[model samples]
Target: MNSIKPKFINVLFSSRLIEVLEFILEEPKTKKEIEKTLKISTSHLAQVLSKMVDMGLVDKRGDIVKILPKGEFILGVNRVAKGYDEFLSRFGNFMNTYILDDIPEWLISRFYELAEIEIAERREDVFSPHPEFFEHLSNSKRIYGYVTVFFKECINFFLRLAEEGREMEIIVNKGVLDKIVENFTEGFGKGIERKNVRFYVSKKDFQVFFYCYRCFLFDILLFKKCFFLTTRKIFFANLGWVIVPNSKSFIKAIKKYAPDKLEEVIK
Candidate 1:
């Protein structure tokens, strides 16, 4: 049997249709119940219901209105669409900081799963979260990420973490890795011999000043700090960090970037 193709764009874009579908999704109700719930006139409610029934989305029996399978499917798609819309609205500022023109829309949409994104402002003379990010790195059992910028303080802590039997797989810029080889070669040697640390240099030219330890992920932007405008750059006092707890969706998103594959590509 051929399934009917619903023209769902109208339902997706129309708030009235979305609202009516949501109400019907909760439970089947009568026309009077929908009219009262939506605070719409009887004529308007009748028109909406009639449109839905003609589209094979709703079935009306006497005074009762029930959503059919087609209606339920449309509702499911709309929910996901709304989720992505909400994400873009809430994180417009955060996402706008990056040049994502080359990134696929599907991958960008998955970023909506990053819940509880936070933005904090810092001044030149005040404390910053660099210490806290490093502290969490030291506390974590395993760490994995790409780092385009290097700090002696952070390298020292990675050494300590390796010595403490923590596992780390890091991809760093050539210059950053060179600095580590110069300053921490002995520590890196010990870490490598113990099989607790592995490092690779990025083949492509790009900056990666961030960290990921277990469920916690951080990004440091490279913009300078100003007294007036908030900056998204890392390696500066005014930095923005995006942290997300472990969720299946989040894990799937990180995996798409294929940090592991990047590791092999470098070697």
Candidate 2:
């Protein structure tokens, strides 16, 4: 009589089989030892061991049971599957907001480096960034940004940083550049002349903001489409900021997306 072949999925899903394989993978063990560690009934253990041996996943030498090379390979695959499962679970909420393509390949590959993600709605608080975001700006020695608008406080912060010898290079909206000149012409004028800060105006209208620093990065996304928050009120859109700490890769990403050599393209 020929030995029956075990269904692969059924054997893979069998808790006792997995538990026994995991244990045996560590070291060869006798049936009595496995029973003591797993607390599985003798009959069930026998059945699972038989199926695994038939599938060429386990080898029994006298009383000692050890996982075969095939079994180790399967376990390695399972380990990878488990890691992806956990990664998906952790970032599921973020996925619901945007499709996979929206995320850059480099960032996606280094998803484990994510420090924080924030979404702020206008209804909740308009133009309000977290306190920590300001701290990052204050401490930065160099700043590069692609920006659309600025709050009064933000402009003031940049001015102070510039005074403290921080170098700022920004690609900004025309209105924002005009506002900075209008509000602080003398200070900004000196900063520009002294090469402490430089601004390039963009012709294309864009609302998203991106900033890169030595060890910090900010990605601020603003939605300004025909979406509505309510029947009477048109949706002003939320700002989604992803803050990354220890941002060497993030700096690279920012440079790639918002090139500093954008003077020729400035309109």
Candidate 3:
């Protein structure tokens, strides 16, 4: 007879077989005895036992059946698999309830692609910037700053937000401000007056700083090559801005260490 598929047999025989195996290993049982004790029909029990025997999962000698080493291994693996499934089910429910459901919708929609990219990079041991950092910047209704490469994208989005009459305070480094003012002169000429825009010379201190309403604040510290985006609640330092709690302490530390560079544009 053809073998029963492993998938079907795995589900059908797992619980019953484990109990029967434990009982039989304590004392070997004939097919009729196993059927009667387990409350299974003899024909069905025989088919299950036959499949287990054919798969080298059990041993049958004359009328008696006993679990083989292979059957024990399968039992251990199935128990662990069941346990892991339960853990994942609870974990997924926790994330949906306490984490994913609480984030703002606008931030969620705008940064979905960037968030996915960062998650993929994290799996590969690569450094990809977090989307929450940018989302914080994008949603800023007060002072903002941008380096040269980021200036255009920042201004474009900022201008649209301004059209809706959202209050924004913006400060751009002198170098990037010049480029932005030149390229979008007509738009900026009219739009700049409508929004609070500040131009400050590039200083040796911090590169960028902004407050997101009163809930969070950010400061960008540029080093030789890499940059640090620091965030805080109120005004603390050591809080590095990766969207985790406890950023406020980090921000306090950075402010104390580098007061000159970290200018607060918004209260």
Candidate 4:
């Protein structure tokens, strides 16, 4: 008697063929039975069963075909394959509907390309968060900078730290001052408490000229979304500072270059 090898049995485990075998496992069935149960055509079912017979996965007697022990093993592999396919399908749909819905189309295309390039380059330092970056800022006594767009995540994080007694001095673009004023007022609550968060609005385009002492920069250029957040390591070796749209140079340059854009944001 020839010994049945696992390798030979594994060859019959294609996803489509496994579905056919599973139908037979539920009940010993002929080619016609498999065709009706699996919704495969007669010709396709015959071709697959023929291959399985050669691999010792199915035993055929007259019109009836039964799944062998080897066939059962292949069915197990089919279950795993089907499970993985289902998981990926659901996950893909979720990302398409939720996480990606708000993103602009042009940015989406660029983001995907950038992701591929980032994966290929395998640069470890790219977006790896350095706690020391924030630590240095917290230790600094004087901070001078401005921010544009006023990202909520960055503001909230900094505000939480400031509430815990960290001193942070920042300048913001005119476009964001009103909103920041509201957040600062609400965050710290009435009277002199809100004064701790000193904010200035500049008459120039803050986006083009803000600089920080702690030189850290990150750009998120997604479709219809182009923003950069940078922290500069200035002064002390371990201490750094950040700049936003309200930074002195930032305001000065905006006044010189794009003064018209600043008219609405300035105090």
Show the colliding residue pairs in model 1: 148-208, 220-234, 221-233, 221-234, 222-233, 222-234, 223-233
How displaced is residue 239 in candidate 1, in Å?
8.4
Per-residue alpha-carbon lDDT of candidate 2 for residues 1-267, written as tens digits (9 for 90 to 100): 998876576655566777888999988999999998899888988888888899999998778898999898777666555555665775565456545454544444444333223332333124555656676766666665555445656666667777788766556666667778788878777666546665566554445344343333344222221111111211112233333434434435444656652442221
**What local distance difference test score does each model get?**
0.59, 0.58, 0.49, 0.50
After the best TM-score superposition of candidate 1, give how far the Cα of residue 264 lies from its true spot, in angstroms.
Answer: 30
The TM-score leader among the candidates is 2
Worst 10 residues of 3 by lDDT: 116-125
TM-score of structure candidate 1: 0.44
lDDT of 4 by residue, 1-267 (tens): 998677654554476767767778867887777777678887887787888888888998887999999889877666555554554453354444334444345434444433322212112223332445455445544344454454444556566655665444555555556666677756634321543454455565433343333232222221122322222222111111232322334334444544554442212
Error of 4 at 231 (Å): 28
Cα RMSD (angstroms) for every candidate in the order listed = 12.7, 12.5, 15.9, 14.5
Off by over 4 Å in 3: 1-14, 95-267
Point out where model 4 deviates above 4 Å.
Answer: 1-13, 88-267
Backbone clashes, each candidate: 7, 0, 16, 20
Error of 2 at 185 (Å): 24
Candidate 1 lDDT over 1-267, as tens digits, reads 998876678888888977888898878998889999899899998898889999988899999999999999988888778777775675555556654453445434444444333343333233234545765665567665554445666667767777888766665656666878899888867666667666566555443223222343434222232111222222111232332323223223333544543433222
Error of 4 at 157 (Å): 36
